[model samples]
Target: MQTPPDRRSFLKTTTAAAAGAALTSTIARSANAAGSDEIRFVLVGCGGRGTGAAAQIFNTKGNVKLVAVADAFAANAERALKSLSRGENESKVDVPPEQVFAGLDAYKAAIDVDADLVIIATPPGYKPQQFEYAVNKGRHIFMEKPVATDAAGVRRVLASVEESKKKELMVAIGLQRRHEPTYMETIARIHDGAIGDVISQQVYWNGGGIWYRNRTADQTEMAFQTNNWYHFNWVCGDQICEQHIHNLDVGCWVKGMYPVECNGMGGREQRMGGDASKSQIFDHTFCEYTFPDGTKMFSQGRHLAGGWNHVGEHVQGTKGTANPGGWIKGEKDWEFSGKKVNGHQQEQHDLIEALMRGEIYNEGEYGAHSTFTAILGREACYSGKVVKWDELLETGTELAPGIDDFTIDSEVPVSARPDENGLYPVPVPGKHNPFA
Candidate 1:
């Protein structure tokens, strides 16, 4: 494995002086206030993952406080706040009802509050906009994975990454596997030649099914889709980008490069009782990705019940084989025997510690690129044609145009109404124009 480049070397000389001065000031303040000063943060999107991330932050060593919270729904924000205001986290949380915001634009209010960090766990569709806002505010960020739902959104995130680096802000994405001790040890060895020259890989996120929320009689089309985001393409990007991205990301990490081309097949096999009206996303996908080095990665992602279930990655190398999560199977086999840690919790710990040390590390670039990789596979499966990284990224359709101005009463980009047969339109291979 090649030695990782020093992050400082990539700093722009034009901004080097300013960045250096900022870093020095930050280091001194952080070092002096380590355990004394409060590190306040705001939460945007009070869903399950958002709540969990807040809990982890409270567990970190420091004087951290949850200053504000926001969600598309008021109930979600309230519920998350109630959950956090229990046991050990209760004292650390300072959010009052006034600071708990709701509605599509609520994130702006929460982010506007005085805070050192912002945690974004919104649906993938909302991430790019929210992330750009956080960076503009000059707040550190800890955002969830699959940074975007479409190539357009990925482009937006990539742009924000540059601004964040210029400001020397610390940005951590929720690809927690990179922070897991076991995965770290195993991948380090792979890069060190334990799994010499990875040739092929197999990754899977095959699972049973996901939760579905029935549209209530009083709910608007936008409300209904937001409630059941997992079933929508505009918001969720299907299961491939939503859930299967982790495994695909591991494949890319082992190869140290993104796939150049991909083709695949997928459809809504057993989803919503085979009714397309209820869901616009595919339930199963099989993607064949070709890396720039000509290596292939066979990817599988399924949501059908009673099928084989798997959620890991495997790699084949010239000199050996490896399960990048922890083990190598050739040229002196080895296993990770380190203390197992919860990646979700560990990631928070790492971010907070690095902030105290004033060390800036931005994961946004790879996060956006890996997300686009998943989008590439999804497009291939949807179009039933080979898709190249550059072409799709340059011409792919935006999943939600004018997303920055969305409101609760705004019409959704994808219709929720059913056809005469009570079926929603599902993407048909060979007919879907991914770049349209």
Candidate 2:
């Protein structure tokens, strides 16, 4: 398809605008002082990310225990259970054969278990409602990133955020970049203006592509979307929210605030009409985020074949620029900007300790803002124009396909042709782009 003029210009201006928007936002963190110990956990999603996170949480000390498991697929739940450490500590798990749940309401099944904490590791589409359920039941939570696929879902998460704080529930989102010590130290320095007045930053997460392959004849869009939830817009919120959200979160962390507006571009670069099931989400997205203090974040993410060696953050100022790992370069030349950096292990362990010590802790509001920062940039890239964070914050577009019944016919198409005219809704802002 020929490049549309509107789209072309949108891409061009976005690049220029990014020259000054770096490190304008940092994730707001809340870690209450240590209190009395004892916290149990229930994992809702059991895919690789979920299981891997479970492992990290396990390594955390101070009265933390995994108790239950739940997934839409039986195999997923079983996989999570099997991968966990088996000992007297893990032996008290509430998930036996009868306790493991598989179904649309698997989260409820897991939440119904006798546990004090829950992990919403399922697809983002279900995160809001599941989180609400967990919060209502009064449980501390450790949810994966991309809080919700759409604005309303975010609203739901925000609602839960309020209640969880009221109950003093310990809620942590799995934006592990916050846990990566190298980035943390670098960000602290940037905030301290070690590089002088911050000017801009460039963050990229590009690769040859991730799990987007053809589905067999036996697989339907519904089945494929549910199983490969990370690739579905309604489920994972695209690469921007799923993968790039990390970079966005880093931007938020470095800037010490949230972006006010964003402009971007995204499309199905490699997989257009091949098959709806193979890949239904945008493969690449480039966005310019303008934060409250006029800092810029040149955020970019791509899954194209043979792309750049990626996955890092760079904060720039009048003095220097550095990757999250403390690699800094400027007129003074490259200098390792080592600071106090900690990984997910330490972060989770600290949170658990805080919980045990009865310290105030909550990942609700701060995590939501960071998650939306990524989502807003995504909406910009999707629509080929700037979008206000306010609009995104109140957006009601829902990608959550609440399918009551799953069958081949009930599947949502993931890919399509733009027709002979090469036309499709490309996430334009403010006019109710109803293409979802």
TM-score for each candidate, following the candidate numbering: 0.92, 0.80
User: How do the residues 1-436 of candidate 1 rate in per-residue lDDT, one tens digit apiece?
Assistant: 0111122332221111211122333532232223557788999999999999999999999678999999999999999999999997889999877999999899999999888899999999989999999989888889998899988899899899898888878778888887787877787788788978899999999999899999899888788888888888888888988889999888887777778789999987798888777889888999999987688999999999999999999999999999988989997999999998898998888788777666766777777877888999999999999998888888888878999999988988853345678676678999999887
Angstrom error of the Cα, residue 428, model 2: value is: 9.0
**What lDDT does candidate 1 reach at residue 85?**
94
Clashing pairs in 1: 1-191, 276-424, 277-423, 277-424
- Tell me the lDDT of model 1 at 303: 95
Q: Candidate 1 overall Cα lDDT vs. reference?
A: 0.83
After superposition on all C-alphas, the RMSD of every candidate to the true structure, in Å, is 4.7, 8.6
lDDT by residue (tens digit), candidate 2, 1-436? 0111132332232221111111112212222213324466788988887887777777666556677788887877887798785665464354668788887677887898767667788888778888999988877778888788777677778888888767667677777666555665556566556777677888888876676535567865566667767666676778888878888777666666667888887777674443443455777888999876677899888888866768877787888777766655655444454455445565567556555545545556656776777777777776676778776665535554453333334646333223345342233334434233
Q: Least accurate stretch of 10 residues (summed lDDT) in model 2?
A: 15-24
